[model samples]
Target: MPPGGRQVLGADLGVVDHAACAGEEPELFFHGDPGAIALAKRICGRCPVREACLARSIANDERYGVFGGLTADERQELQGRRAAA
Candidate 1:
């Protein structure tokens, strides 16, 4: 999938769609709202896909929202810390 979660659908890949960015843009809203983030974090705290989701967010350098229950600024800080280390 593309970094922004956009993907081409169908066998021909000619049609345009956003299925990958669907389902839960909510999942990426932790940066925009603290209360929502807290709620999502509670759920993600126990989700099996948390690691996978976090990995994707970091790889994508997601800058506008949250993923895996982490805010954009938090993810950036993590990246910075890793780079510094």
Candidate 2:
């Protein structure tokens, strides 16, 4: 995927306009490879709807792919921090 896995969420594609990851290889977003994950995150770093993408991932508890420049574990840590705060 380009970054935040645009096409994978065809349903939410319309929700987050101009997804940066659009048309990219979806597998890149879900890859177990660290390098691929980093590439996806880099793609997400340039995305306009990054916060929105992250919000959606957090809201849905998405646990399998990169979103909003964060890996699943990162998202969990973010949520933990938010909860603690």
Candidate 3:
């Protein structure tokens, strides 16, 4: 059993190119596409470790695609609100 309903880190890995993520100019998770983001949110909705995953992404400053079903901007916005509080 894994934390994210999968047995691996990159399991069910979507189309977001990791190379682009690792590169200097990272691609935005969800590609700034609302439909894709909605799909991602649906996936995240069922994740067992959703909170842990989201927290990890925020803490690590993940600059790439969605994590715990949240887009990069959503995560950043959440992080900002958390910091403000």
Candidate 4:
């Protein structure tokens, strides 16, 4: 996938889209501080593929960075909810 998670055409199938973060600087998502996490979440909040991104992160068990506008703690909570259901 290209940087910034832009959609790409599959060689013999439908269009494939990447996460919005793919286009952004890697540091923006990986910064290990509260302010950086907040900024990254703000960016993700406006992403068109926020749901997909979050779902992918959760399914993949991502251990760091922001995805789908949520922090690691938030994702963990969500995972808990999913397990409860």
How many steric overlaps are in each model, in order? Answer: 1, 1, 1, 4
The sequence of per-residue lDDT tens digits that candidate 4 reaches over residues 1-85 is: 4543443232311211544565778888888888988889888877777876777667667778887888778999999998999
Off by over 4 Å in 3: 1-31
Report how far off residue 79 is in candidate 2 (Å): 0.3
Q: Can you give the lDDT of residue 14 in candidate 3?
A: 40
Which lDDT values do the candidates have, in the order given? 0.59, 0.84, 0.60, 0.72
Off by over 4 Å in 1: 1-31
> Residue 45 of candidate 1: its Cα lDDT?
68
- Candidate 2 lDDT, tens digit per residue, 1-85? 4554434443455656588888689899999998999899999999988887888788778998999999999999999999999
Q: After superposition, how far is residue 3 of candidate 4 from its true place, in Å?
A: 12
Residue 30, candidate 3: Cα error in Å is 4.8
Q: Write the per-residue lDDT of candidate 1 for residues 1-85, one digit (tens) a residue.
A: 6554543222222221322323455545545566877766666665555655666667666786656657778888888899999
C-alpha lDDT (0 to 100) for residue 17 of candidate 2: 59
TM-scores of all candidate predictions against the true structure: 0.63, 0.81, 0.58, 0.72
Top lDDT: which candidate number?
2
lDDT of 3 at 35: 75
* Selected candidate, larger TM-score, 1 vs 4: 4
C-alpha positional error of residue 46 in candidate 4 after TM-score superposition, expressed in Å? 0.5
Error of 4 at 45 (Å): 0.6
